[model samples]
Target: MTSCGCLMLEKVEGDASAKTRVKAAPGAGAGAWCGSCAGDWRGRSEAIFPIYVMGSSRESTVAAARGIVDSPEDPIWVAVKAEAKSEAEKEPILSSFLYASVLSHDCLERALSFVLANRLEDPTLLATQLIDIFNDVMLNNKDICRSIRLDAQAFKDRDPACAQYSWALLYLKGYQSLQSYRIANILWNQGRKVLALALQSRISEVFAVDIHPGILSI
Candidate 1:
């Protein structure tokens, strides 16, 4: 089963009891499984399920999707790095800062971890310690990692002033504060209440955005 430049729902060769596997159709450029649909279809016995595919055939779709998911560098990170490099070349004063903040890191999570740690750090809570915590949380939790990029994309899309994704990531205090709160919330859930509160304090002090770490509403 396939559609023109769309998703291909194919039945896997296996026992009848086996769950169906889903992938992009060939020529489907960088396909992604729809979250709601995936959740709904998970563990079901049905062989033919509805999926949304943007590109073409089964082989190419699967390959493209795999490349996007398995690849260490994503489009968002690549764009941010390119923008940073361009800005660095144009403005000599910001070159060093851009290098340290965006260019030096391999991915959005690492760069964001560094930026947030530095922004929230103080005499008591060192930047190194915060980086470890942030990196641990962000890298370990794939959802958090995805959300960071989505938030960066949102800033670029929604804010007229935000000309580049790197600007939103590096300079937006609101964005920083939001990400800090996410980490703090995770800490609170993991029973690190004291550390979460400490992060909350730093968030308040630095970004002037007061949010309780205990708040589950992200």
Candidate 2:
């Protein structure tokens, strides 16, 4: 269903279930998860709890719900990634999706969703785009994004409270061409091919995240 910020309780697309769309109980505060069911609300907007449960069949729905409520402690990042995959399918409906899952998912999932959703064509703009959304997520959805930036910042040895959350460390690894992408654009007027290649190898070893070679070559 189309949303305009306020909580929406529309039926799922093609849903065959007889259950009615549920709403938060009266007087429930923000980030409160109240429903007819006995389960506790895990997300910020009470609205998201339902959408997260829109998978096929009751079993799948329960499994999806568990992903959000469970700790990121087991299997580490896998649960976070599972939640992300669920959110990704609901894109462009993201404002509502994010609002719904806000409290359910952790800070890391929130920041990463911003990154995954906004991936684009221009290689040179990658870092800038990541930082821009990171800031927006931090400023606009501080409750969710704050801890993520702090965690990412801690990895870089920077103060968690720092406003900018310089993405240098996060972006620096993975693809070989990313290093080249940065250098190529930074000194666009001056060429530095050799140093770019060296940076590429360093990224591969450290991040284990691969860059599309074609993206770099271009």
Candidate 3:
């Protein structure tokens, strides 16, 4: 793994426990960097503690810092994933989607990136391309993902019809619509007008919810 700082994205592809590894730096705290010669790299304690820059660092660091603490996993996502695991064990039929969508990912943003990419992807527009874009957006501006979590949480907190995170994770069209709009809005502001409009149209068609691209978000 290329060394950026204290934390490294250590992956043993097939190993469940090795998805991502973070080495705490020497101060022996959450964000402390390793003081050893090989691991030593000058940086702030708060910066390296959590999942690590995982940026000069980019807008991603700024965005991600808002949502994450000392770990990569979000508590809300953890609870939802546990529910998915239980549901998968109880119902064999839903296992494939459950595992592919939620269980396979290490973080909430990653899973969202995968699902949205697949949903929006087409023959000419590859899933990899969509995934890359989604990852970029999420990493650069994690407030987007945080907004999504809040949106999903709102359903569970407020809507009587919605009781489970899995349902919002998998089947909520309105939630999907809002997320698609947010992604498209990012692209639109970044001067990718055509792609943004295309996504907006596709989102409307898929979710049956119309959202104006030109409309300003509060």
Q: Give the number of the best model, judged by lDDT.
A: 1
The reply for model 2, stretches above 4 Å from the true place, is: 1-54, 57-60, 72-76, 79-118, 121-126, 138-218
- For candidate 3, list the clashing residue pairs, or say none: 25-32, 25-33, 25-34, 26-33, 26-34, 30-49, 31-49
**TM per candidate:** 0.67, 0.21, 0.64
Q: What is the per-residue lDDT of model 3 for residues 1-218, given as tens digits with 9 covering 90 to 100?
A: 23334543233456455343555444443453444523333233224343322222447545544454434567668877999999999999999988999999987778888888887777888889988888888778856866777677666654566688767767777776787788888888888889888888777776787887657361
Model 1, range 1-218, lDDT digits (tens) per residue? 23444444455566666455556767765554455444433323132532322222348545644554556769778989999999999999999999999999988889999999999889888999999999999889876776676667667755777888888899988788889899999899989999999999879988999989998444
- How would you order the candidates by lDDT, starting with the best? 1, 3, 2
lDDT of 2 by residue, 101-139 (tens): 332444544444444324321444354554453344334
Residue 146 error, candidate 1, Å: 1.2
lDDT of each: 0.77, 0.38, 0.70
Question: TM-score-based ranking, best first?
Answer: 1, 3, 2
TM-score of 2: 0.21
